[model samples]
Target: QREFTQKKTFTSWINSILAKHTPPYVVSDLYTDIQQGHLLLDLLEVLSGQHLPREKGFNTFQCRSNIENALTFLKSRSLKLINIHVADIIEGKPSIVLGLIWTIIFHFHIEELARTLACTYNQPSLDCSSAVDSSPKASRSAKKSARIKERWKMSATKALLLWAKEQCSLHGSVNVTDFKSSWRSGLAFLAIIQTLRPGLVDLEKAKARSNKENLKEAFRIAELELNIPRLLEPEDVDIVNPDEKSIMTYVAQFLQYSKNLPESEEDLQEKVREAMGWLAAQEKKLAKLLVETENETYYQKCKEMMSFMETFNQEKTPFLPVLSSKRGEAELSEGQQQMREEWDKVVSQINEWKAKLDQMLPSPLDSIEAWLQEVERLQAEDLPDLQDPFKAMSVFREIIVIFKGLMDCFDSHLDTLQSFKNEDEKNMPLVLPEKLEEMKRRLFSNIRSTNPSTFLEYHYGLCSAIANEVKLKLNICDVKYGAKESVESLLENW
Candidate 1:
């Protein structure tokens, strides 16, 4: 599902939760609960920190591949969270950033379309062609060809990197720079985006040549892969700003975050650019450290960490996780049906649970007790079904834990706390005349059996049951959370 996880945020938390579970359409319902602003924030995290296991072990350079293949059969459907968020943004539907970037992409494609049409015809139309032409300049037969040309020009690869750089630049800091999934994919992406390498035109060819077993793969091969003819290479090309400064030196330095080589002047510039993009603008004064190279230095330590990440991605040794199955499929069949049978059993259990839900709790009071019993029964009926069933149990058990707290003890003395409370509950003290007590005892004797303690426990549990209901009412599960380190000054008071 997700190769990397930063559970502190809502989307990542959802992704993290989903990563540990199975089956589709489970948490998809919670989508409405997540706020629009928070989704954008999590999407930003993916643009920044989502990682992969491209690196094999301890090493200097590390790589992690982006989820270039398969959207169908992931073991966990965590990626769905990303897909939904990104798709929404692309549709010009995101409520935040005013859909500014989505609008940008839209206008961007208009420009790309004109460029492609000119490229395809080998020249501009003799007549001015409006973006949408009433009179077809090209025959209907050639529409398919025009569409392909347009498709080639719209690179997910290029868009993603420029998107990264823009986002980093927008954030004004490169303090958190885990762009793309892995260095391999990131480098390949950069090669196409900035270097104007066209080999990525055919995603299929790129995929075939970039496999783990393909030893012929290289950082620059993207230029030749799709086109089948080597037309460009960053190694041979020189990048420079309008000011006549070589840009390769800058890119080389940026790449050196995971390298130990001496910093090139251009390299230092790139480093500064990326650092400035990712780090907060407030830290601009400290930006010079990116050029430092000596050991025991802060910049050196930063470089080593990048190196470790890069090395990890490149090491896909035998011990590291391998994908022997075909790419793009979430699950690779091992030619074994045993695992399949177990998975089916769990699905059946969940299905049966849905079917018997009403029967399981015939009475409202019974629902609370029945829920706890049902989960235990479900677990006992098939142990494997509950094995890492994070989706079903987390919120479920949180209710159980709250219920247990309500039952263990009641802070009856609380002007604010009580085992039981209602908005309509009066603050007046309990008062009853002896005549009323005698009548109440007589009424209780006639009623035969209702234990207040047990009733109170049941009532408390019932209130706890509605906790999920409250979370639902408030649209809470989608709230984003982050780790915080209390300042030493703040902790001094503690």
Candidate 2:
């Protein structure tokens, strides 16, 4: 009972192992067949165990013996079984086949496996027979066994080589140096598997020579393909008006291409150097052009400012009343007091104008001029790094907006001044005449109550006094001219 239980347990264990290790796409029949082939299972267990830690009680020599015994036993099987099953060994569980081959190489140090592998799938074996040792039947059986062994070895080795080639190809595209290293290691491993060190050395030399030639061809192709002159065309560079960035992009691309080329190519290196020099010269030219453009822009702004000033000077007129103290006596009569109060109101308006003018000065235009002067100085000294053209343009644009606003203020001020001037001119002449007529009517009505001559003399004295007051107040015209002069002077200074 115990023996049967152990057998059942072992069967279950092998089944699970095969299921876990075999790819899912492999049919269940393949696993079952491999499981029933006890010799192959035993060999797989031993070979797989070799990769485990020593603590797992792995025996290297026992593993080698197991693999040899498995191959030998497989040789004794029918030719149909050997061909079908051994091919399935490679097709169904290729990783296991590779592991077993690597294990054989590691333990036995044989080279036949790697050699047979390279040509197995495509090449046919010679049917040469060795001299018989005994009866015809025995000799024929021995020859058949040898043929089967050779066939199984070739199939297994071919599977392993195919797997390695696939892996190496994957690594090659990602990193050529790593691919080369893997290739060398694979060659070394294959040499040990086939036990053919001299053959591997020759193969390695041939491969290295071929790789060098291919690398030279690839470099030559790259040199011809990266046409730097066509890439750095003038039309392409003109995408950004001042094309510094475009030129630099072309330079960067050229440098990147040059970095990949072999350093031994002196002609390519010389071309790269010349291209870099040309790009450097182009950069300098662009920088100079930028500076000249900025200078021209500033000059244009200055012209605009000067032209605006000329128009402003032509359009500017004094808006304030020119009041003379002599126009009104220090002791003002009632009507004269009203005139004086109005004059004070005009002065207040002039004060307001002065305040606004004060706020507008060191104006945006003046600020732009100061900024331009600094930029010009930097440019003249060849210190282009110190200038910011964008900032300068922004300031210039703001000054233009501010000048427009100031012109609007000037227009409003002129309108207000003209309205006030019209009011004074329309009302001033009637003020004195109306007051004198009222005084004449009052004096004539009281003539019967006093001496006629005395009353007439009093009326004349009053008339003279009124005339003097009117004369004094009329000097506001002079005050108007004085205020206008002040405004003109302020504008001139501005």
Candidate 3:
């Protein structure tokens, strides 16, 4: 069932990409069309913008060779293929072919969507230098930006997940954690449509409906209102396990539609400057908040966090439309990139502070599940790479202490759960104790496996190599024709 849907969805998606070529290519039959490997090579070339070598012969060996060449190209990009072989694709193995096409869609389409979300329609390239000042000083400043955009890259799976999560966060109680079961209730789709095109889906009505009903309506509205292709039926997604690939393909269309919103260069630049100013202001406010709350009490920190969240929503929510409108261009400028880096720092500090406060607070059995989830989230986050050893070590020690406290907190909660196990089942959740025990075992296993010494050693090595690389250039500044070169001119040229 899923294979059929993926084939249809992926075929349309492939033809969409191929349609942009000089002489457009279309895949009528996904399984057999690529058996000759010419179309496969064409598709790869179209996706990657890289010319690939292919066999022009009609022989089976030549066909297999072409397929192998495509496989090799995929491998060169560091894409790990599991149980996928050249013979499977050459033979037109249905499942294998579907998997191969899905991989291509995930890599070239879905993964690339995040970076392209900020660009206008038909504008894939993000080099909008003319949108800002093109003076030598501005150019030099642009070159020195923090490269903050690179940090936002994630796997295609994670990119879709983050987009869904961000969209669903605006709606009520629609938490999109993963691609599979998260959309089972169908509220996620509704939330996405409602947020993207306001008033498209009625949340109050959708809430009262059954899963299948909501799923059907969301798909209908998305297709009718947004012109998004109906890639999946209610029965397909409202299942015990919905197909992640199908949902991603369908959701990616929304991202495509989102980037096409009309805005003039003048308006876009004005919005960009406005967003830059807002982010700059936020950086200052968050920096001050971080310092003030550094040694504050748990209650004080909680108060600050709550107040910050309110202020954040009020101030930041207004800019979301413009930010989403020109997301790609926002990170391309010197001022925008610097502001984004500071904004990223602000977010990182908030997470760190939240983790600290969580450790200081106590949790009842009812809220322990939420607490555990938060702890797991915090633990799953990788430590940031700080060039300064002092900064890195300080952060490492603070996190370690919070984690240690969380372990103790978990133990204390576990003991409480165990005590209530013999009590009435109605008053307490029967599965809570077993669930906590399982979680505890996993948490402890992870903690035991983690060696802090290894991290510290790695950090030490990174610190030593911080300034190992340098880009040095010597330029001769010759003032000619009795005209003296200004200091600004020399600095800009330098």
Among all candidates shown, the one with the greatest TM-score: 3
lDDT of 3 by residue, 392-441 (tens): 66677677677676666666766665564523435533332333454454
Off by over 4 Å in 1: 1-227, 233-237, 241-311, 317-331, 334-494
Q: How many clashes does each candidate structure show, in the order listed?
A: 28, 11, 2
> What TM-score goes with each of the models?
0.15, 0.13, 0.54
lDDT (CA) for every model shown?
0.28, 0.31, 0.63
Count of clashing pairs, candidate 2:
11
lDDT-superior candidate, 1 or 2: 2
**Looking at model 2, which ten-residue stretch has the lowest summed lDDT?**
126-135
lDDT by residue (406-465, candidate 2, tens digit) is 334433333332332211333532122322232232222211121122223334445655
Candidate 3 Cα lDDT to native: 0.63
C-alpha lDDT of candidate 2 relative to the true structure: 0.31
What TM-score number comes out for model 1? 0.15
lDDT of 1 by residue, 1-494 (tens): 11011111122224433343323112232233222223322332343344323323322222111111111212132322233333443233434222232322223322333333333333211111111111111111112222222233333222222222321221111111122222222233332222232222333344455333221343334324332222122222221211101121122222222122233555544433433332233123123322243234332343443443234223212111111100122222332122223322432332332233223322231233333333223221211112233433454455456545543322221212122221223553221122123223322221222122333334444565566566664574345434334444433543
